[model samples]
Structures are given as C-alpha cells and as structure tokens.
Target: MTLPTPLTGVVPPVCTPLTPDNEVDVGSLTRLVDHLVTAGVDALFVLGSSSEAAYLPDRHRRTVVDTVTGHVAGQLPVLAGAIDMTTLRVRDHVVAVTAAGADAVVTTAPFYTRTHPAEIATHFREVAAASPVPLFAYDLPVSVHTKLGADLLLDLAAEGVLAGVKDSSGDEGTFRRVLLGTRARADITDFSVLTGAELTVDSALAMGADGVVPGLGNVDPEGYVRLYRYCRSGDWARARAEQERLCGLFAMTAVGDPSRMGGSSSALGAFKAALHLRGVIDCPATAVPQVPLSSGEVERVGKYLAAAGLL
Candidate 1:
C-alpha cells in the first residue's frame, strides 16, 4: 500500500524483539509484527527509540528494517528510524534502511554536539535530499537536547524537506503551535503531525494531530486503533474512555524502581514484558547497558495489562 499523503491513525514504534543473546529474534519479531497487523494499526515503525535503535549496531538495525518491511510485504507502510548524531551518519542509515525496504525515514536533529538552528536546518535538508523515501522529523527534545521549534519544523515542511513530524517532545504548547501552523498553511496539506505522548492522545487528536506514535501502542495496538477510530468518528466520549484505559496501562512504565534504572529501561522493559505476557514476542530482554526489569516489575506490568483488559 502506498503511504498516505498525511499518514494517519496509530503507527506504533514497534519494539525490537531480541533473543537472550541480544541478536535480532526474527521469528519473534515476525510474530510481533503479525500482532500489530492484526490489531489494525495503520503502519509500523522499526528501529526507533521504542525499538532500542540507539543501542542497536548497524547490522541489527538493517536486520530489523529488512525483516519488518519484508514481512509486511507492503501491506503497511514501514517507517524506519535513521537516527544518529550527525547528518552523514543519519544519511547512511537512511540509505541502508531504504535499501532494506523501509517506506520512509524518521530522524532527529543533530545531537552529542552543540548545533546552531541554521546547521540543524541544513542537516535535515541534506539528509532529506539524500533519502530515497520521504523524510519525517522526530522531535524528541529530551533525547536530542534540541527542541525543534515550531517555526523551523513548519518552515521545513513548507519547503517539502519533511513529509511529517512525530512530536515526542512532551510540550503541549509547542505541539499545538505546530498543529496550528499546519492548519494555517495552505501549502501544508499533506504533512503529518503525530504525537508520541501516550496519556494525552485524546487531547492531541482533539487539537488536530493527524495521528499518534505511542510506544504503549506496541502492547495494546487494538486500544489505540479503537481510540483513533473513535476520534475520527467524532465519538469523543468513547475516545476519552479508551484513552483513559491506555493511560492506566502506561503506568506500568513506573513499575521499575528509579534508583535501579532510568526511565528508558523501565518503560521499554515494561512494554516488552507486556508484549511477552500477551504472547506477541518470545522474550522481553532489552539491549545492554539498560537495566533489566526484575521479575516483580514484570509481574506489575502483567497486572497493568490485566487491569486494562489486555491479558
């Protein structure tokens, strides 16, 4: 299927299923993909933050994109994260994932070094020019350390340098500003604005976001799909209910003790655990350097799933 002009609906940043040894578990990954497909998600995103792209080496990254895109066989658009600290590095990922059959590439602004906004703009332009598929900006200020200002994103979108943006900044003011800018621009009809804020999905959709890229959606994609459909159909009451249930499930991210692990480990581990508990993946092991959730934490995630009716 061709990517929609403004890609809409729930596009989960799929968790990368890995073996106990940290290799790409292709069989488990395929099962996870099938699970998402069965849940009616509009698209799949691989090698993203939720997929541990930051920790994955180039080889595993390629395997992920190749496996997911090849498995889907064009049934859904596969957006791969071409993430790196510099333009050249990110461009290389773009080429590799594109060659591996990704439908589009999502990248963040330069990181690990202080960069002027002009340089950031140049970086995106150069990367977009080199990418074979459409490019989407990943606005994740927490990770990248540079907020993608609304004007800059809109400017790039207006210039056709970006096909869309997945705003994970957790800044409602700026997200709304970007949405308003897109709505105000006559030339920005086909640009997508997706929110990664799991708890505020209903509010984001009500504020005109085109879609959501919730990491939690990886576990309960059916819920996000239902929320999207409810919002699209103007069933605000039902939309809020679904959103609230997902919010309850999202609390599982807090199950891991903060002193033992950072939010990435806790949240990602909870997600993988839930996927494992749901029988979507074989193992819930996250990449190295990130602390693993204890059995107690995993049990807590199961409780959240049960409370959300996912179990």
Candidate 2:
C-alpha cells in the first residue's frame, strides 16, 4: 500500500448546510469554510458522516466538493469522503471529486455486504486504482461491521494502494495493534493512521496517531483546534480539559434523544442549528425525512452552545 505522507493536526469532517428547499446552500458552505479556516482548523473533510453524506445525491455531493475546495482554495487540504456502497459508484465519485480538486478521498468499507478481509482488500484496490488522488481507508465498523484487520492492512501496504486507514471502530486494542504493527515497517512509505472517534481523540494522539478526524469539529471548530494543538504539543492535561469542554458542546447533539446522540437525524440537525446560532451559517436544514431541529431541541442546543462559549 502506498503510504500517505505524515498527516498531522485535527481534520474535521465538516457538515453540509442546506437550503430550506433541500438544496445545497453554497453561501452557507462558504461561510462554514471561512469559519473553520479562521478558527485554525488544519483541514476540511467534506461529505463525511457528519455531513450526512449517505443522504445526499450525487449531484449535490459533487457540488459540495466543488464548493468546499473552491472556497478553501489552497489554504488547507480538502479531503472528500466517498459514501456510495457500490465500488463502481464509489470509483465514479472519486473521479468526480478528484476532478473537482479535492486533496484526497476518504472512503468507508463496503456497507451492504458482510465484507471479508479479502473482499475489503479487493474493494479498496479497485477504488485506489480508479481514484486519481490518494484514498484513505475508512474503518467505521460500528456502522459497517467490517473491521479492517492489521494483517489486511499490512497486506494492502504490501500491494501499495492505501494511503492510510481511519480507525473509527473505537477499539483501543485494535488501534494499538495496528500502530505497533505499522510503526516499525519501512515498506509502507506513507501509511498514516487517523483516529475517527471524537471521545478517544486525546488518547489516540497520545498513542502516536498520525492525526485526528473527528465529527465534533464541524460545530466547535475552535475548541477542536485548541484540543488538537494541545494534544499534538504533548500536553495531555490541557488536551483533556479542552476535550471536556468540547464534550459539553457535543452534549447539544443529544438535545432531543440522549440515548442515541450521534447518527440521529435530529442530532445532526441540532449541530447545524448550533452552527447557525453561532452565526457561522444560515438555514439549518437537513435532507428528506430529516427536517430541521425541533423548537425545543434548537433552544436546548443554543443554550448549550452559549454555555460552551461557542454561540
């Protein structure tokens, strides 16, 4: 596998703002990108899970890629996530985003099928071959249930396709194993490993993770930047403190339902609403079936943001 150059810093999986009519809000997107850049975010990852990528259509997804890349310019590297389950469709998305000037592609493992290790390798191999830019192996086994084994990663590294893997499974043991196995290897020139879970970001950094890719950064950009810088600087105490504050803002994501804070339509809506309240964007809307946050949820999230000094 082709190793990605050492990628350091906190890269947020930014959320996509939408118009009331369910169309992508280019204006809001520009505002959001500007907000993140001004807040000192290292990079912007578009069309990620936090962005509701799975619910977006191809046309809108392409528009998001162009909007984010064009707005960010070359100030920060912009990586776009490829969410289509079909390899052919994902390949097409990679080609599309690459043409749109994305720095790289972050793709999840196959979702519909129970992908075996071998199939995962094959899938990524095909996607890497088709993608003009490098591909980041997305390992969100919680959502897809296919953990990217260390042996498979080593094998893929041997084949020279992947740039790195995003370990979002939140399995510390698995993460440690991957790190130990890949750290001493000299064959994988650019294999960078990124931690995907937000709660474990500080711990992941302390464990020598290449970088952090968290969803919470979409709303609390400055807090995430501060937390990440602290971690990268090896200040666990300050990092932990900032993480606690970050978690407070993240609490707003559970305004409607505390049990399922993330991956909920309302939670995402709450995040966008919080961003809107903070004046970063306008029109806090979601796609079909998932409307904007309820009045109470919005109020709660707004209050939470205010408490966190974000609004």
Candidate 3:
C-alpha cells in the first residue's frame, strides 16, 4: 500500500522478540504484530530503536522486515529502520528492508564521525537518491549525536528529499518550529512530522505534529491509539487523562536498577517483560549483552501492567 501522503496517527515502534539464543523469533514477532494491528495503530515501525535495530545483525534485520511486512500484508504501512553509522551502510539496509517488502525506510544522520551540517544534508540527499521507497529522517540526537536542524529539514522537504521526519530529539522548542515551519511552507506539502515523545503525545498533537511513534506503545498500543483518537477528535481533557495514564505506565522503564544495567537494558528489558507478562510473546529475552531484568523488576512491570488495566 502506498504510504499516507502525510502519515498520521499512532505508529508504534515495535520491540523485537528474541529467542533464548537471540535469533528473531518469528512466531512471537507475528503475535506482537497482531497485537498492534488489532489495537488500531496507524502503522508498524520495525527495526527501530525499540526493536533493537542497532544490536541486531544484518541477517536478523532482514528476517524482521520480511516477517513483519509479510504478516501485515498491506493492512498498514510497514516502515523499517535502516539504521547505520554512515550513508553507504544505511543505503544497503534501505535496499535490504525494501527488498524484504518494507513500504518505507527510516534512518538517522551519519554517526561515529563528526559531521558538518553540509555533510549531513549531503548524506541525506545521497541516501534518498538511492532509496527505492520513501525515506524519513530519524532525528534522534541521543543516538546519532546530531540534532537535525529545522532549516535543514525544511530545505530537504522543499527539495523532496525527505518524505517525513520522526523527531525523537525531545526538544519541544525545535519540534514546534518544525511543525510551524512545515505548516507555513507552501512548497513543502506532504511532509510528515511524527513525534517520538511517548509522554507528550497530547501536547505534540496540540502543537500540530502529524503523529506519534511511542516506544511505550509496545506495551499499551490501545492506550496510544485512544490518546491519538482523543487528540484528533479535539477532546483535550480525555487526551490529557490518557496521556497521564501512559506517563504512569512509562515509569516501569525505570524499575531496573541503574547500578546493574544501562538505560537500554532497563527500558527495553521492561518492555519485553511487559509483553511476556501480557502473554503476547513467549520469551522476554532481550538481545545478548544487555542485562536481563531481575525477578523484582519483572514483578514491577506486572504492577504497572495491572494498574494500567492491561493485565
């Protein structure tokens, strides 16, 4: 299916389910896909940050894209992340995922090397030129170490090099500027600006963001869908209430002991644990090298789930 001109509504960044040995568990992956699709998300984003794309090998990434897109079967757009350290590598992923049946590809700026804005612009243009499908810029400064400037994004939008942007920078001021700038630019039609801020869906939608890619939505897809519907229908009160509830659920990410694990371990571990508790997937095992959540942390995830009425 063709992507929506301006992709809108809730699009959850799906978490990858791993086997005991760390292979992509296709059975669990499909089950998770059904969970999100049945919950009424607008799209499915696989191999994203939430999916542990950075940790997975190239073969596993292909398996994920192929599995999800084939399972989705055109019900909704399947956007795969072509995350890498530079242009050529990203291009290779873009080709692989698209060949594996992804509708579009998302990527971040080149990283691991200091890059100028001009270089960033050129990198995007080069990648876009080679991409077989629509390309979305993933502005995740925390991961890429490069914040995508509004002017650069707008300039690219004007040039039709970028079909959309998934802004995960968490900078409200810059996010608002992108929204307003896109709205004000007559030449930049069909440029989607999706927010990755899980806790601020209401405010971002209020400020005119096209949609959301909430990682927490992996655990509570229905909540994010409800939040999106509430915002789109102009029910600010209901939206705020739902957002606050999700904010509470999001606290589960912090349940892991900081002394024992890194942020990815805590956050991603919590998500997989929630999914396991909810019986959507079999094993809650995260990719290797990331510490597993303790039984205590898993119980805490259960508490969050129970409180959210998900259990």
Candidate 4:
C-alpha cells in the first residue's frame, strides 16, 4: 500500500506486549494494534519510546515491526522506531524496517553522551542517504541529550535527509521556530513536525505543526483521534476540552516517582496500564526493574480515568 505523510492527527507510540514468561507477546500485540486502528488513529508507530524499544533485542525489535505490519495490512501508515545510537546499528535497523514493509522510520538522536550539531546533522544525513524509507527525526531532547536546532533541521530538509521531526523537547518556542523554518521551504512541505508532548498538542497545531505523537493515544486512541479532528476542523473549544481530558489522564503517569519504579517513571508504563484497564491488551507488563504502579498510583490512575470517562 502507498503511505502518505501523516502530517496531521495522532500517531500513538504503542506499548510492547509481554508474555508471562517475559517474551514479546506477539498475539497480544496484534490484538492491541487492531484495537488502536479500529479506534481511528491516523497511524501507528512501532518500537518507539512508548513501545520500550530499548529493552528488546534487535531480533525482537524486527519481530515487532513484522508483526505490526502484518496486522495492520497497510491500512494506515506504519512507522518503525530506529533506536540505535551507533551508526552501524542504526543503519542495520533501517535495513530491517524497510525489509519488514514499514511505511517510514522514526529515529532519535544519539543519547547517553551528547554530540555537537555538526555531528547530529552528519548522523541524520548518513541515515537519510542510506535508508530505503523516509526518515523522521525523533527530537526528544529529554531522552537524547543532544537537541536538533531548527537551522540543522532546515539543512537536513534542504538536503532531503529528513522527512520531518517529532519535537518532544517540551519547548514550544523551539517547536515554533522549527515549524516556521520548515514551512518557509517550498521543498520542505513533505517535512512534517509532530509534537511528542501530549500537553503541547494544541499549541503545536496553533504554531503550524503537522501532527502529534502522544503516548496517551495508546490507551485513549479515540480521544486523540477526536481531538486531532476537532483541531483540524477549527473547533478550538471542543479540542481544548478534549486536550484537558487527556491531560488529566497524563498527570497521574507523569507525576509518579521514577527512581524505585522505572515503569511508573515512563509514559509507556502508564500507556500499558491504561490499555490493561481498557482490556485492549492482556497484561500491562513492563520489563522488570521498571516496576508496575503501586496501589496508590493505580487508584489515582483509576480516578483520572473515571474523570476522563475512560474507565
């Protein structure tokens, strides 16, 4: 199937399913994918930050792409996360994602150690040149210490090295700058900017962003789909109300302690927990060491869900 740029709408970073034995639960994953698609999401991004790609082995990651691709059957755009920090690893992932029939690939800047803007530009240049599929720069500075400047982004877009970026820096100013930079280029219309932070969806759209990649979309897929539609339709009032609803759900997960409980530390765990609540997936299992929600946290999540009418 031909895949178009999902310039607007919600693309959920789906949670990775796990077996009781702790393996990738392929069956559960397919069901979850089907559920999200049925709920009206514009696209599906696999092995993303919310999908916990860093925990899985390369083989497992490739399996996830294959599984989701087959389940989706080209109904919507399918984006695979390129999670490698090493050049060789990133290239290998690109090869695998293309071979698995992914519609596009989303990649984060190298993390753990920060690299210069020149190096960042070079890294994406190499990937974009070698990749068989379009590359979306994953710009979540919180996850990756290195940030992509709008000038660097413009250079990449000019060179056709980047299809777009997912701006999760939580910096609306930077997002606006990048959006304006990309929008100014006639050749860069193909370049899209997605808001990775749920709280910034409305602001990003108002700033001329293309779309959003919200973790909450994994659980409340319908809410996000509705929210995006409302925004695009110029119904700010309804969109604002929906955004508030999602923010309420996000607060519980965002407020948890991350040191002792790594799962609670991430939106991924909260995403899975919400899925478990909705019965979309069998278990809300995050990899070990990332502890599950505490009783208090779970109760708080329940209240948030009830208030949001998701429970």
Candidate 5:
C-alpha cells in the first residue's frame, strides 16, 4: 500500500508480545494488531521503542514484521523500524523488513560511535537511497544520544530524503519548531511530522503536528483515536479532557518499582500487562533480560486500567 502523503491520525507504536520461552508470540501479536486496527488507528508501527525493537534479535524482528504485515493485509500502513547503530546496519534492516512486506521503514540517527551532524545527514541520505520504501527518521535522543536539528531535518525533507519523522526526543521546543518549519517552508511539502510522545499529543497537534505515534495507544487506542478526532474537529475542550484522561492512564508505566527494574521493564511490562488484563493478548511477558513486573506492580497496572475504564 502507498503511504499517506501526509500521514495523519493516531498511529500506535505497537508492542511486541513474547512467550515464556522469549520467542515471538504470533497469535498474541495478531490479536494486538486487531485490537489497534479495530480501534480506528490510521496505521501500525512495529519494531519501534514500544515494540522492544532494540532488544529483539534479527530473526525475531523479521518474524514480527512478517506477522504484522501479513495479518494487516493492507488494511492499514505497516511501518517497520529499521533501528540500528549505523547507516549500513540500518540499511540491512530496511531490506529485511521491506522484503517481509513492510510499507515503510523508520530509523534513528547512528549511535554508539560518536557522529557529527554532517555524518548524520549523510547517513540518512545513504539509507534513503538504499531503501526500497519510504523512510521516516526516528528522533529519539534518549537512545541515540544526539538530537536532530530542525534545520537539518527540513533540509533533508526538501531534498526528499525523508518521508516523515517520529520525534521522541522530548524536546517540545524543537518539536514545535519542526512542525512550524514543515508548514512554513515552501520547499518542504508532503512531509509527515509525527510525535512519539504520549503525554503531549494535544499540544503537538495544536502546534501543527501531522499525527501522533503514541506507545500508550497500544493500551488505549480508542482514547487516542477520540483525542485525534477531537483535535481535528477543533474541539479543544473535549480533546483536552480525553488527553488528560489518557495521561492518567499512562501513569501505569511507573507502576513497577524504579529500584527493581529499568525503564523498559517498567513501561513495556506495564503495557503488556494491561493488554493481558484486557484480554487482547495471551501473555504479558517481555523479552529476556528485562525484569518482569511484580504481581503487586501488575495489580497497580490493573488499578490504572480500571480507573481509565479499560477494565
């Protein structure tokens, strides 16, 4: 399927489901896809941060893309993340996911090795040249350790090197600048600027963002969809209410004790737990090495769900 020129609406960064043995749970993943699609999301983003793409092995990544793209069957755009440490490695992932039927590929700036802005621009251009499908830059400085500059992003957008960007850098100032630049620059057209921040969807949309790629959307797709519709219709009052409610639900990510587990363990574990409690997926287990949420923490997740009326 051809990606929407300016992809809009709620696009959930999907969560990967795993079995006890740490293998990809195809059945659970399919159900999770159905849950999101049925909730009126515009597209599905697999192998994103929410999907634990960084931790997934190459084989597991391939299986995830194949499973989701096959199950979606063109019902909506299936964007797979070609997340890696550098240009060449990201290119290989791009090839793998596109061959597995992904409609587009999302990638972050090169990491682990220190890189200059010139090298970052060169990296994206090189990957875009090699990719068989549309490429969306994933601006996640928390992991990549380098924030994307709005000027550089706009320059690339003008040159057609990037189809869109998923900004997860948590820099509202830069995010708003990019949004405004995308709108004001005559040279940059048909570029989709999506937010990967869950708690700021309303503010992002108000700032001319094209859409949202909220990981929390995996747990409460309907809420995000409603928030999107409210924003598009100019219902600020209703949109704010819904967004605040969703933000309350998002507090589940902190249910796990910080001293006991890492951020990935707490956030992803809470999401999978919510999905399991909602009966959308079978198992709530995350990948290996990441600690599981304690039973009490899982209960805390349930409380958040119940408060949000997801239970």
Candidate 6:
C-alpha cells in the first residue's frame, strides 16, 4: 500500500460518470480507469472535486471508491477526498474511504462554518492522527473559501501532519513558496507539491512542482503524460507546444454559456462530453443540480475535440 513519498507525474482528479438517473455508471468508470491506465498515468484520484465529490451521497461515494479501487487492482495508488464542514465529519470520511480501499486521503480545512487558523491546524492534526494512511492537505479556496497559507503548510509538513498538498488556489507565488519552503528543510525531503491548475503544468513543473492533478487530464491523460515527460527531460519547446494545445482544448469549458450555467458545470460537462466523444465513457451525464450541457454546447465540445485531434 506504499506510494512514492513524493508522488509525481500526471494524476487526474477523475470525473464521475453518471447515468441519466444519476447513479454511478460502473461500466463507464472501469473503462475510464482502463483508459487512464493505458495512457500511463502515475496514479488515480477517484473522488476529488473533478469527480463531483460534492454532489455524491455517502453510499455513492463508497461505491465510487469501491469501483475505482477494485478495478484498479493495485495497478496505481488511489487517493480519495475526505471533504466536509468540520473535524469529526472529515474524520468519518477518512475512516470510510480508507476502509473502502483508498491508499491515501486528501482533505480540506473546515468549510461552511467560519474557522480560525488554530482551529484548522487542530482539525488537520486530529484528522491525521485518526487516519491509517497518509493524509494530504487539499488547498482549493474556490470551494473551501479558505486559502491555506505557505507558513501553515510548511509547519504542517515539518510536523509530519501532511504527506503532500493538492493546490488549486491559483496563487503561483504561494505555490513556489511551498516548493521552496519544502526544499529548504533538510527533514522535509518527501513532501509533494501538486498543482491543480490544468493550464499551467509546464510552468508548474518548471518551477519545481512535484506533479499535477489536472481535471482536463481526464479528457487527455496521454497529453499530460507527454507534457510531464517533456518538462522532466528539459524539452521546453515541446512542452510548451503540448501545453498550448491543451489550453486550446480547455476552451471547451467555456462553451456552456455563462448566462445559463456556472463555470463548474461548463468545465465538468466539457470533460465528460469530450470523454464520451473520445469513446472512453458512456453517457456524459453529470450529477443532479448541476446544469447539463445543451445540444449546442455538446457540439461545441466536439469541435474542440476535433481541433485538438481527439475526435
């Protein structure tokens, strides 16, 4: 059950494929895992933000973990999100996902309730103390509404309260600060710094990030794998080219008219639609309450795919 201390390479926060009736689409999911496995992704992340973790019930969340971990069969390490509004709830999720076969747990600070840094620190320490597997802090201010400062992260890393960070805060300065902070510490040799910014993998890698958890990687894992390899080999030109192509493909996320749906719907819908068009999944349906893409939006996604040479 051991993962590389500083887990590296492309790890897409996998998208949850749903049936029209809003159930987890098992067949599509296993096939998606098979697709990522074939593409040579370093690991699998099943129930993160990209996986619609916010929308799933406890039973469905467990089903997702069981399905992905069971199908993966130990081919790659699996990390599941243990997100909630408080310490006890997150600890319960940590217990559930790990018991269901998650190799590690990624969690965020308490949300939906105002909290202090002291409370947040206590929350992480208590949660980590209760977990069997390694715990990673997830710094996604957009959803959690609390940005994890570099000082706090480094302090946590120093104390061994966190295995790594999955950062989606879009703050490049803090990203570099975390990377620099970790390298400066002789004892913090294995703390990973993974960026969730899909558009900037090349920049992130060049600046010494450990890896990426790009949501767009779900639609194109091989592209990210190639990009990561290019960066590792110091092939800046090729990496830039690959990243530019992916950036263009990412425009599909904006096809869902802003007036009609939120950015989350646009992005997740585009990923699923692209996956369906790529023949990697069946029924590009997202969960309920998130507006689905329109016929026009789906066609726009197909055009982006065609342009990206994915269709």
Taking the tens digit of each residue's C-alpha lDDT, what string does model 3 give over 284-309?
99997999999999999999999999
Q: List the residue pairs that clash in candidate 5.
A: none
Worst 10 residues of 2 by lDDT: 257-266
> Looking at candidate 3, what is the lDDT of residue 50?
98
Model 2: which residue pairs collide? 1-157, 1-160, 1-161, 3-190, 3-191, 4-190
User: How much is the lDDT of residue 206 in candidate 5?
Assistant: 92
Scored against the true structure, residue 70 in model 2 reaches a CA lDDT of 85
* Candidate 5: 10-residue stretch with minimal lDDT: 175-184
Q: In candidate 5, what are the lDDT values of residues 119-194, reduced to their tens digit? A: 9999999999999888999999999899999998999999999999999999998988888898889999999999
Evaluate residue 223 in candidate 5 and report its C-alpha lDDT on the 0 to 100 scale.
98
Per-residue lDDT tens digits for candidate 6, residues 1-311, read 68889899999898989999999999999999999989999998878899999999999999999999999888899999998889999999999999988999999999999999999999999999999999999999999999999999999999999999999999999999999999898778689999999899999999999899999999999999999999999999999999999999999999988898899999999999999999988999888798999999999999999999987
RMSD vs true structure, all candidates: 0.8, 2.5, 0.6, 1.7, 0.7, 0.7
TM-scores of all candidate predictions against the true structure = 0.99, 0.93, 0.99, 0.94, 0.99, 0.99
Q: Which stretches of candidate 4 lie over 4 Å from their true place?
A: 255-259, 263-266
Going through the candidates in the order shown, the clash numbers are 0, 6, 0, 0, 0, 0
TM-score of 4: 0.94
Candidate 4 or 2, higher lDDT: 2
Please give, for residues 1-311, the per-residue lDDT of candidate 4 as tens digits: 55575355778888889875668889889988988899998888998878888778887898899999988988888999987886667888998998999888888777765677777777888888778888989887776777788888877887888888888788777788888887677866577888998876876787788888888887788888888888899999998998888888787676456766554345566667677777777877787667667667666666777888887
Q: Positional deviation of 130 in candidate 1, in angstroms?
A: 0.2
> How high is the lDDT of residue 23 in model 6?
96
